[model samples]
Target: MSIDSIADAIEADAGEPIPGLREGLEEMRAGRSGRRYTPEQLLVRSARSTLGLSQQAFADLIRTPVATLRDWEQGRFTPPGAALRLMEIAVRHPEVVRDAAA
Candidate 1:
């Protein structure tokens, strides 16, 4: 007859108990969490750090110039169209990058 009754009827038809609805509601509650960085960004950082390379050295590894790497890191310049795509690919496929380099 009412909304609550209608919900109960639907739950009954579905053969599901609604008693744990509170748990579902609690699960829906928002929680604090940090935002994640993009794969390309993380890869750039990791590649540089892992190789113990400066921006210039990292740039060389990625087949770009030092200034470009610096710009990418500092947000002063984007990696350029194709360059950005390459960075994304490298990020997603680190082993590929390494194998290619070797």
Candidate 2:
């Protein structure tokens, strides 16, 4: 396809009043485009990456064990009601997690 044809196709596929196109374009042009991750998400992803740990290893670090972590990540099982509270607290203040583990 010609350049104009390709551009038009892209615009059509993007759909609906340009959506966040303007904000995305501005961020790109300014070289400051990125995403925001929650602290919990960041901590979990970082621990997995930093230690070259599998899901199992990640579970071990958080003291939840491999199978339970897998269940949590996969949504197969909800952690115990209490564990969820602890997780939220640990996500907010990871040092508390370390101290508790110690």
Error of 2 at 12 (Å): 16
Which residue segments of model 1 deviate by more than 4 Å? Answer: 1-53
Query: lDDT tens string, model 1, 1-102?
Result: 554566677688889977855444444454533354555556566656655667876687877878778766655555566776666666677667677878
Task: Report backbone clashes per prediction.
Answer: 0, 0
Query: How high a TM-score does candidate 1 get?
Result: 0.48
The C-alpha local distance difference test score for the whole of candidate 1 amounts to 0.65
Q: What would the TM-scores of all predictions be?
A: 0.48, 0.44
How far does residue 39 in candidate 2 sit from its true spot (Å)? 13
CA lDDT for candidate 2: 0.62
Q: Whose lDDT is greatest here? A: 1
> Distance (Å) between predicted and true CA of 75, model 1?
0.8
Task: Give the CA lDDT, 0 to 100, for residue 94 in model 1.
Answer: 62
